[model samples]
Target: MTNALTITDVRKTYKNGTEALKGVSFGVRGGEMLALLGANGAGKTTLIGILCGLVTKTGGSAEVFGVDIDAHPEQTRSMIGVVPQEFNFNIFERVGDIVIDAAGYYGIPRSVAAPRTETILKRLGLWDKRDAVGRTLSGGMKRRLLIARALVHEPKLLLLDEPSAGVDVELRRGMWEFVVDLNAHGTTIILTTHYLEEAERLCKRVVILKRGVVVQEGEIAELVRASGAKNLEDFYLRV
Candidate 1:
């Protein structure tokens, strides 16, 4: 399969002289669900930010489906959708409009964006609350709304950043199932989550970061066998 994303010797440094990503490199295969594992301050967020064009890379390269992100930023954005770790939408906006308008950013006409918006909203179980304001949704619904917004444009690559954070157990599991279904239907997914078991269960491959660099990476089973660790969590702590 072709690569959905490729990162080669990618580097990032902040204005304060801190290196947040130090020559990190990895490839996510087409139709692959990859887990980006890291502790806090491990450059996970920075990496995602770079992929989404929210942060600029200081060196090296990143590409989406063979298209260089820096060279063709608009094309990159058109191919990828991101569900950020935080709720960044306007609280006062109508729920449906928040999602529908997101498609406008991609130049999707309102006629096409509206139906797609409704479809994603209903699939995420937020159809009944379409008229409600963003602030009125519960934690789970709010998380679902982020997903709906990401999916409305039918992006081929989806970057989910701590999507289940603050979500209830049942709701989180439901999301897992939904995401699996999404991948099965052809969307490549790169997931960043603090939940080790969730990563083990959902992703085929993983890249673990420590202090802004790739410390370990491989198939889930291979990493476990090589480290002689009982599970991902045990292996994570050791690294």
Candidate 2:
């Protein structure tokens, strides 16, 4: 299978001498679900920000599919959709309008975005609330709405950053079911979360980061076996 994402010796440094990522590198295969596991300030967010064009890389290279980020930034960025950790939509905007507007940013025409918006909202169980404003929805619904907006453009790669944070168990389960189905249908996903068990259950492979660099990476089960740890959480802490 072709790589959905490739990073080679990527580096990032902020002003005041803070290095967010130190030559980090990894590849995620197409149609695979990957868990980017790390503690707070471990460079997980910085790595993701660079991929989504929200942060600039100080050195090295990256590619989405076969397109180089530095050479074809617009093309590479258009191939990715990101669901950020925080809710960023306008509270007063209607649900349907929010998603349709997201598609518009990718140059999708309104005629096409309308029906696509409807389809995505329906799939995410937000169709009935389409006319409602963003602040009117429950916390779980808001999270789902964020997902709807990300998928409106039908990107090849989906970056989910702490998607299940603050979500209840039942809602989180449903959300994961949707994500699992999406991956099964060929959307390559990279998920970053504090939930170790969730990562172990949902992702095929795992990359563990510490102090802004990768310390271990491999198939989930294989890594656990090699580490002689009883479970994923144990292995994570031990590493």
Candidate number achieving the greatest TM-score relative to the actual structure: 1
Which ranges in model 1 have alpha carbons more than 4 Å from their true place? none
Query: Positional deviation of 76 in candidate 1, in angstroms?
Result: 0.8
**lDDT of candidates 1 onward, in order:** 0.94, 0.94
lDDT (Cα, tens digit) per residue for candidate 2, span 1-239? 66999999999999878998999999999999999999999999899899999999999899999789989989988999999989999999999999999999999999999999999888888999999999999999999999999999999999999999999999899899999999999999999999899999999799999988999999999999998999789999998
Residue-level lDDT tens digits of model 1 in 134-220? 999999999999999999889999999999999999999889999999999999999999999999999989999999999998999
Q: Estimate each model's TM-score.
A: 0.98, 0.98
Error of 2 at 54 (Å): 0.4
